[model samples]
Target: MARYGMQYGPPQRSRVPLVLVAVLGLVLIVILAVGGVLLYQRLDEPDSAPPATKPSTADAVEFRRVLKSEQGQCPSPPSDTVVCDANGFRYTVGRVELNGAHVTEVKAAQNEGDPTWHVMLNLNSEGAEAFTRLTTDLAKKQPPLNQIAIVVGDQVVAAPTVQSAIPGGKVQISSNYTKKTAEELARRITG
Candidate 1:
């Protein structure tokens, strides 16, 4: 059996080499640290290169959402135009009454406590009459067929069902429009 400080067979390997190797590694680390400090001190660089900062994941996601949500200004179509919704349904220029002459004003508004927004249009006498008749006829129909579609430049921005005739010259359009969508619709209507 091996006794204290006695090898069983071959002489035990000395740990001096391993200790020396660890010391060298520590020395190398110190040298690297000192060299980095010296180089940094020698270079007249900015305190920080503006950090090379980039948008965080949340910021990037928000930016993409904003980009995607942007709706361009409304289009200007000819006086007599026939536009269609995503479905096969069609809305004549007469029905919409946005002939670039009858719409007095268009405004985007958000309902209180509601995330959804809408566009309000102040119409002229002619437009108001046509719009009222259209809404009255649509109110009697069923489902989507009963909805009065607001078409602009081949796009049906809104198609809301009318339960009763909107008598006033002002018309409020609501189709769960976001703020961007509502603003775009208003711009189109006014234009």
Candidate 2:
């Protein structure tokens, strides 16, 4: 019964410090939540970008077909890049499989800030005949666009026309490209 204004309920251990600490922790949590929300919004915004980003895989069927065509070419260097051998010979992608081939002793980029390189190719009599036939047929057909694509590994390098019959197995390609590029293409085609 020692009653010195002490109420015998639970002891009120100075609530001021505990309340202040709880309020500070709550404020910090709210600030962190708001900052997180703002950061997320910034990252979601869109920005300008170039178009030519990734390689085209096309349709699954087309992909399979292209893969089949490239398998015979060899994956040792991959179709998208160039390959080379010990010899000085440089290979160029042809218009068709075994129809024609681009052959060159050297591949140098056009000087003065140009990205083009010159390439030469050869075709046997059979290849020339095939090229002529395919081109003639294409001329008659109404197509979106037709090109004789040269394939290196699994990538398309160049594809030109027959011009005439290319019977002499000689043709040239003036590619809009660079020096490193020229060497790369040449290596891939020949190697």
Best candidate, TM-score-wise?
Answer: 1
Whole-model lDDT per candidate: 0.56, 0.42
Q: Pick by lDDT: which candidate is best?
A: 1
lDDT per residue (tens digit) for residues 65-154 in model 2: 011122233446443323222222223332234422322122333444444555444444665565456555545533212334444445
The alpha-carbon lDDT assigned to residue 119 of candidate 2 equals 47
Clashes of each: 0, 13
Off by over 4 Å in 1: 1-98
lDDT of 2 at 9: 78
Clashing pairs in 1: none
Residues 71-122 of candidate 1: C-alpha lDDT, one tens digit per residue: 2333345223344455544444333233445556657777667888876666
